[model samples]
Target: MQSALLVNGTLISDESVRQEDILIRNNRIISTGNNLSGQPGETNIIDAGRKYIIPGGIDPHVHFALPTPEGCSCDDFHSGSLAAMAGGTTFIMDFVTPAPGQNLIEALSLRRQEAESCLLPYRLHVGLTWYDHTITSQMQQCVNEEGITSFKVYLAYKGSIGIEYHELEKVMHAAASLNAIVLVHCEEGDLILKKQREFVAAGKTSPLYHALSRPPETEASAVKKVIDLCRKTGCRTYIVHTSAAKSLQYIRAAKAEGLPLYCETCPQYLLLDESVYRKPLPASLKYVISPPIRGREDREALWVALRDGTVDVVATDHCPFNTFGQKDKGADNFTLIPNGAGGVEHRLALLYTYGVLTKKISLQQFVALTSVNAARIFGLFPDKGSLRPGSTADVVLLDPDYTSVISADNGLQQCDSDIYEGMPISGKFSVVTAESV
Candidate 1:
């Protein structure tokens, strides 16, 4: 690989930002300091004038090419990785969900084939859908041989993928034994099912009712359950795509008690409110995700969590479905709507525009939430989330003054509709480099 020298830019990290030059060689950062030098004509030299160079983002929660009943999510690894690179995310950690009767290793292999078209280096978080005696041995193989240190479990979607509380405890016990982290989708399945039945009985089956079916309390209740289980099992736990204020309070309390609890909220929950669900049918259906987009109070509370350290990272769930062919399949029933939104291509710019520009968080906090925190929590660490010497040369050059109107028309994903259409954004990724791994 060709080496390069990046000069005259501000280097931003989780802790600080400083004007520095960077030398990249053999897919790793060889040096970073003031007035970095390189042999003329031997190394490529690029000037990042008036731009901020930060670690390429690491999205810890994504479902690229996720299979659904009707078909697959709109973005496969090919298009998904393209979108991620455009948004300055160079590495992704996607889930490996086992189909019914499939082993964890088989699921991992299948997902690897699905992600073979990926343009960036990626990792897997094996989702433990069902538990068997053989699962314990499989979990060990995944951690030791596959180098997968995280596992995902859902508390909703009961029959399809969700596991019971006892099963969750068993999974945590195995993960703890291997010192692996467990990521949970915390929404009480029974509560959601009960609400769904009530809503259907009341003749309220529109997209708006999707949010009503899975209330904030459902997520908060499940979050408490998982935390308590993790506490008892001594397993490190991460709550994924947390979207409720009450859940944040529980996570904060758990952390205060010295629990190794970490949680992440998506940009959708931070920027869009449940009010989107009240929009026109086609429009609202785009935001019909699990533990759906919450109200303004929850959005505000999520931002506060990021500011106050109650939340550790910001990730885009990045599961996209087209309105015409994909999401519209559920027009008659909200429950059938594919639950996801397109954000991998817009995460960094949106966060910079909304969080950093509005002064809700500092630039340092922005780096922490977007890159470092996820890296540390998910075990990517100094290699993927930092620009330090010896780290992977995954860097993004952002133009703080770049102006653009966000739209799916210009986005790189395979998804059809743009949820953030016409929203004005200030910063843009001018240059992105994802070195080969």
Candidate 2:
């Protein structure tokens, strides 16, 4: 059996941080406590002095090898997973978006084949792009046979991937019956499409107009609608990449009423704002993400939500498109720009510097947001999120004193441009260990 011991490290969990030594046998953690000992020549001992040993991060959202009108996303599963591991993330949950008329199980199998090159353990949340009487049975098959427990439905890309509220209600009902959670991209598609037409007509087709078209009201309205549906159906629902403050009020009220509504905000939503769209040409185009980055007030609201537990997880909507070929394809028009940015390789360092060091959130809260909460919410729990005995031996050793600036040239992601370029960050990973399952 493969065995290793990690000693003299401060172990961080969702509830607390304390010095503990962890013993691993094969892929499982054998124990975690003070002064753990292993027989000489039988086990390898590794020192983790002055480091914070925490559960490996689980990014609950990412798009690898995603096919769009322009082309496939720059980073495939292998490259994206490499970037994830470089940033101390051990497990990632990506979506399996089915094509029109594609069977959910078949789509999942195909996505699994594409993800075979991924370096770390991963799971998929199947997308319900189109609805029919057969969907309910397919969802059950996915849960029982495929180990997929989450369903993603978009309310943004209308006529393509997005479904109407009535369709969403059906999906919610089906998912609720199966005890599965629904992940929603909460943007009013009709409103966005109307605005897009207006912008293009007036010749306001810049990236700035992209943000202007999808105002906070659109997201807020969709959030409100989704909350109402959750109350009606009693289905657990999660809002993905919640970008506006107005949206949180509805989520907070839903949760207050004990509704099974969860919210996720990305680093871009919390740290970057609408100002990026105001920058020059191609520079502005990269920030043209869906439910575009909101204003400073929304940014501040997200930070407050993170501190107060309104936000459940901080995942990177890590879809990357190169500026030269992908993003700039729509240089004369904003809608054609593939909406995504890369941050999987910098989520930990950026959050550690801005979130933990700045006191916006505590170390325990940091652990929860980055790894623990995601694990618990997504049903990975002790196996992937905790350092408890019998858990998967996936750990990250963080050097608190280490500091560096983020640049695309040094990043592991295949993309040529980074949204967080030139951002200075504190703390770096000293060692990241993930025992393959």
Candidate 3:
């Protein structure tokens, strides 16, 4: 790779933003400082014009090109990572579901091959599952060879991704031994299925009923189980796409008891609510995430947790289902909706627009949520989430003073829809640096 100097931008990695020049030799950042003038020989020069620079974001929980039985999510690795780069994210951890009768390693190989075909810019993290003990070592290969060190286990979805609490114990024990992080999608599957049936039987088939069927009680109960299991195994656990405010209590209690437990919430949970779907025909199917987007009260609570120390990180559970083929599958009832939203393109902007600019969080905290803490937790620290020496030249130059009327017209994702359509953002990324931008 040709070397480059990303000079004179406000470099904001971790909590600090400095007007510095960054030097990239090969793929790693070699040096950084203020008003850096590049030596013209051999080094490619990039002038930032003094815009804010951030560690290109690291989205630890996104599902790309994942075809659910119901409908297709909008963005593929190419389109999704393009939108990610356009929005200032440099790396993503996407899940790889094991194919029918295939083991975790086989699934990972297929996903890795698919990702390579796109010649994508962002570094992608491979996600493994502990559905079968036979593949635990194979999942470890993702970390050992592929640099994919994280795994996910769902507490919802019945026999599918949901491993029983005992299986969760097995996952925790194994991950602890492997030194990998375990992410949990915590909602009681049996409860959701029972409640879904009850809603259908009781004629509560509206989109809003989706939220009602998978109640907060379901999340709290299952999360408690997952937390306890992690505690027993001495494994570090992350609560993924945490939606229910009460569930944070379980995480908090685990933390208080000195368990290495962490939690991540989404912008949808912090911004939108179930009430949005309460339209007569239920436009709310648009926000049907697994632990569904909650109410205004829950939103405030999540914000409070973020502002406080209870929450560890903020990630867009960027599972995008296009409004037509994906989301429309649930047109008859909310339960059939594929569980995700298109937001890798919108995460940093949303946080910057609402979280920092609005004073819900400090710009420092915004950096932590979007890049710093996520990097540390996922073992990509310094290399992927910083402007320091030996890090990827991946960076996002931002115009905080600029404003845009956000819409799908400018969207880079292949998906036809976005849930946050029509919102305005104060900042937009003007330049990106990688092997290629």
Judging by lDDT against the true structure, name the best candidate.
2
Ranking of models by lDDT: 2, 1, 3
lDDT of each: 0.89, 0.90, 0.76
Q: Write the per-residue lDDT of candidate 3 for residues 1-437, one digit (tens) a residue.
A: 37777766777765675677887776777788765554567667776775787787888888778877874466777787778878888788777777544666677778877777442444444344335656567767766777766778777888565667877787678889888778888889888999998988887777788888888889889888888788689898888888787888777778889988888998888878787667554356667777877878778888888888677788888877766766777777777778777788888889999998889988778888988888888877878778788887667788888888767777887766667878888888754643333
For model 2, which pairs clash?
Answer: none
Better of 1 and 3 by lDDT: 1
TM-score each candidate: 0.97, 0.98, 0.92
* Residue 263 lDDT, candidate 3, scale 0-100: 85
Compared with the true structure, the alpha-carbon lDDT of candidate 3 equals 0.76
| Residue-by-residue lDDT tens digits, candidate 1, 224-339 | 99999979999999999999999999999999999989989998899888888889878787888887989999999999999999999999988889999889998888888888
TM-score of model number 2 = 0.98
Q: Over the stretch 205-257, how does candidate 2's per-residue lDDT look in tens digits?
A: 99999999999999999999999999999999999999899999888888889
Residue pairs of candidate 1 with colliding backbone atoms: none
What is candidate 1's CA lDDT for residue 83?
Answer: 88
Screening candidate 3 with a backbone cut-off below 3 angstroms (N, C-alpha, C), the clashing residue pairs are: 20-33, 73-320, 73-321, 277-284, 319-341
Better of 1 and 3 by TM-score: 1
